[model samples]
Target chain A: MIWQFDLFILVLLVITALVALKVRDLLSAAMIFSIYSLLMCLLWAEMGAVDVAFTEAAVGAGLSTVFLIATILRTTRRTTD
Target chain B: MSDVLTFIISRFNYWIYIVLMMIGLYAMIAKRNYVKKFIGMSIFQTAIILFYVSTGVKSGATIPILEHGHDIGHAAAAINPDHYANPLPHVLMLTAIVVGVATLGVALAVVQKVHDQYETIEEPEILFKLGQE
Candidate 1:
């Protein structure tokens, strides 16, 4: 059961990375990156590192996402092909 | 059937982490957008943190705090030493988190300055503008 959950989270991480790469909009990529970080935090928790997971959840998903979004807003909306 | 599956699953987390880290690195290298690069960098750093934390996991281990009314010798035996988590990874993560935040702050500030000067955020546009000047 637990192993299945680990596999699920691992899959989610891979899918998120692919989505981040394929997305054209910078904002969308940043959001997918945030989701990737959240999945990683859950993975860490499953590995029995609660403290590290907590920090990753906060810093990776929360602060980093906000920072990237702000930068994207300041920049151009459309990415050149 | 179940035992073999569990054994493989238990050992595969680290490999998954490495793959994610590599993907992040590739994105950071191949992407042209500055903000996207920063996001990629964050992903890469987070992957490393995951790897470090996973190493500290041990089965049935209690927290590192000394138990109430227990001497060192008794506490050592009563607690399952084999399962105790390594404190070093946790400590290292704290520092990594702080550094990640600081780097993000500085990177964003630079991005803002670039936008202010170039009037455009796209890297190619900024380069073109600079060349024309």
Candidate 2:
């Protein structure tokens, strides 16, 4: 039963990765990447690594996303492709 | 049957962590944009932290604090006196978190400079402009 949740997270991670790769806009890609990080944090928590999950949540989901958005703001939002 | 299934299921998290990590690394290396690279870097760092924390788990173990009135020396030999995980990983994670933040800060500052000088962040375009000059 627990494996079901793990499998779900895996699927979500794959979908997010695909979106990050296929998205033409840089900002949207960064947003999807942030979602990927958040899903990873949940996976960590499920693995009994609460401390790691906490760090991932705080740094990956919070700080890193903000940093990416700030970078996007400073640069062009469009992709040539 | 259920017990065996449960045993296999327990290890599923590790597999997912590894998969996500590989994807993140691949993106970091293949992506051209500076910001995308930084996002990939953070994802890669996060995956490693997840791997480390997962390794610290011991089945049926409790947090690593001694109970009130418990003797430290005597409790050391007890079979299940709140079998705490290795705190080393937690400590290491704190350091990793700090380092990750530092790396992001430096990377962002560099990106700012790159934007200021090039007036663009796209890797190929920047290279083209540099070649033109």
lDDT of each: 0.78, 0.75
Q: Which parts of model 1 are misplaced by more than 4 Å?
A: B1-11, B60-77
Where does candidate 2 stray beyond 4 Å?
B1-15, B62-83
Residue pairs in steric clash, candidate 2?
Answer: none
What lDDT tens digits, residue by residue, belong to model 2 across residues A1-81? 156886888788877876776688988987898898789778767655666667778887788778878878877788753
Candidates' DockQ values? 0.51, 0.42
Q: Quick one: RMSD of model 1?
A: 3.8
Residue-level lDDT tens digits of model 1 in B25-130: 9878887777767777877887787778767767666444445535666666676456556667877887897798789889888989988888876678788998
In candidate 2, position A79 carries an lDDT of 71
> Could you give the CAPRI-style class of model 2?
acceptable
Scored by TM-score, the top model is 1
Model 1 / residue B9 / CA error / Å: 8.1
Candidate No. with top lDDT: 1
lDDT of 1 at A53: 73
Q: Which number leads on DockQ?
A: 1
